[model samples]
Target: MSTWLPASPCTPPGCATHDGPARHPLPAAALLLAGCALALTGALCTPIALLLGRDHRERLTRAWAYGVVRAFGVRVRVVGRPDAHRGGPGVLVVANHVSWLDIPLIAAVCPGRILAKSDIRHWPLLGPLAALGGTLFVERERLRALPATVYAIASALRSGARVVVFPEDSTWCGRGPGGRFRPAAFQAAIDAGAAVQPVRVRYFGAAARRRAAAGAAAFVGDDPLAASLWRVVRAAGLTAEIHVMEPIPASTVHGRRALAGLAQSTVASDRANLPAESVHH
Candidate 1:
């Protein structure tokens, strides 16, 4: 693996476990179908949605993203407002990765250009839709392509477009410290003189059980996408909380490394303050 491709120690048997009561098989199956139908509808409507005004498209995107999570039986609760950075430079929205749900959940609140792995471009229904929706694809395995990817992100930011990135480069189980934020993407924010918006995403059960709900939502290390999808649909009363912290001005930081460190610490501090759970053995 390229040094740029950081691997997470998190895996299904070691880090993931279903915590909450599960839905009946029949209900879970229905929810899964409903979620898939919503995704398909969104994909089919993308071409026509593109013709609408920017504001209209943003609203539509938000609604469609919100509907996808809801259809999967996950309630979304956003805490704190995102920095408007009104009439300012573009914003780099960074968040930790845990589950596939993180994509739609973040987009529901802050719809922007998603920085995704190139492999996602070939995904069945989502691949075409993501391409149409202006997702920036990065070839993680090709070190030679890194510079080009950075240029593309910087170009988008220079155009005053918000770009969302998962700086960790890998998904964690969301029960412990997540992978460190790679400093590479931070270079784009610096190049474009953009502000870095740090957002912390957490999953919890109906009774506020963080550990259980987080595991159910996590899609990590060799966990099949189909299995993760079914696990989420069958999970009862799972809620995804999005905490949008203050935006850090890239100019205030010395460089990309410092900016990346600052953003990572900002998120880590918040996670540390959450009610503690017994260490996973």
Candidate 2:
């Protein structure tokens, strides 16, 4: 089954320009410290959450995630609310890949284990956090790991965990063509009998997001960890809009290509409303 709705208009705020070299702020460092503290707090509370049911554990996990993002001084603005019904047991959330920040942003909203590129496992502080958050790593080129990854995703879903996957596979500027949504993520949803919830991640009014994208592209041939995280946190505060599109059932969307289109269309329609921004002098 398919559904269509009118697109909402959106425009990112003007980018605040800075003179000379970008300097780090004490608050940013403090936020990092606070996140570490939250992680420790979560660790301490795990046993209690475990005593609760699976639902409680996931809720606590999400609360911990919210703390981390909040501690980072990131502002989350959810545009379209997630459907509570679709959010129930065994749903696969497929979101458009915008930035590395997408991970935590999704975690904030859906609060689930996600499949990330294997390279994320080697990242600095983020690597450890991702592991602790139960992220499943996948090798893009290795077909052998496909089965294991799929099985893991299925297990996560069956356990009432929402599994988030970025169909775009990589980040791109929201201005124009991002990239094609890889079919494997969608295929995994179909194979697992999970419903797909499309989310659009837009980092509005942040010069840092643009700079981060450029730095990431420049470091594509080298170590991205250092450049990536710095660029992400360089801004004063990042305002991200997570618009949840209507959910699509895998049982209804059988073909991988068709599912990919459905996911892209969901994102594209919402993105059409976002206000375009250009860096100023």
Candidate 3:
């Protein structure tokens, strides 16, 4: 189903003045140290979580994720609340992908199994932690593996585990909405009678001013993870905004394609209203 929402005005990239994050860098390398601590902590805690059961493991995962976000010194603000009923299993969260930081930020508010690329399972320090936390990794490059991935997501939902999916399939600069979300993941929610919640994530300066300064937070093209971490930790007063829109009942949604379209439109409309800063200033 097509949406009737008005589109956000877009100017040519160079034509638009990009207002970046305010000039405030941190004094020490706190995030890097925190990363080390979280990694070690997660590793030590993983086995304990497993024996505790899935619910306990998920709780521990959320705690670890929240600590990681705080360790980076990034502030997180939630605009809307996740439905109480949709808070855990029986709910599927769909969000716009901006940067690597999106994972930790999302975990703080809505914690569950996240559908991520397979590479994350091997990242230097964070990889094992993610695996231990019960993340479902997908080989996005392998088209044949999609059905298995979708089935995994469906199983998670059917078991009442909230699965967060990034429909865009890739990162965006957050200047506007990214590419259309692939509908394949939505099929999981449909098969399992779950509600799909759309989450919009964006970055801001300590002042919380809306602007294009997302580059300070975005992990796009050629930007390495180390560099992204440095940029984030060095930037003082950075806050990630999480806008939680109402969950769409998958029970009522007809097709996966239509479900994806509606979720995409919801995110795009919310993004258009965000306050942005002029980069040229």
Clashing pairs in 1: none
lDDT of 3 by residue, 1-281 (tens): 11421122322242122244433444437566886589578666766777887566667777887788778777777898787643444688999877888987888788778898899898996688778766899887777788999899988888888888888876766775566878988998888878899998888774444454466677765566776777677666678889889899887877999999999999888565655433222
Sorted by TM-score, highest first, which candidate order results?
Answer: 1, 3, 2
Off by over 4 Å in 2: 1-24, 36-51, 85-89, 118-134, 206-223, 275-281
Go through the candidates in order and give each one's C-alpha lDDT. 0.88, 0.63, 0.74
lDDT, candidate 2, equals 0.63
Estimate, for each residue in 152-175, the C-alpha lDDT of model 1 and write its tens digit.
999988887889999999998887
- TM-score of every candidate relative to the true structure: 0.94, 0.72, 0.82
Clashes of 1: 0
lDDT by residue (1-281, candidate 2, tens digit) is 01221121211222112222333766656766676677567755654665776566666666776766666556677876666643445788987665556766677678767888788899886676667657889877677777788777877776667788877665554555455777767777777777888887766545535433322212111235444444445555456668877888888975989998888887887554544443321
Quote the positional error of residue 2 for candidate 1 in Å.
2.4
Q: Candidate 3: which stretches are off by over 4 Å?
A: 1-26, 53-59, 85-89, 122-129, 206-209, 275-281
List the candidates ranked by lDDT, beginning with the highest. Answer: 1, 3, 2
Our model 2 lands, by Cα RMSD against the true structure, at 7.9
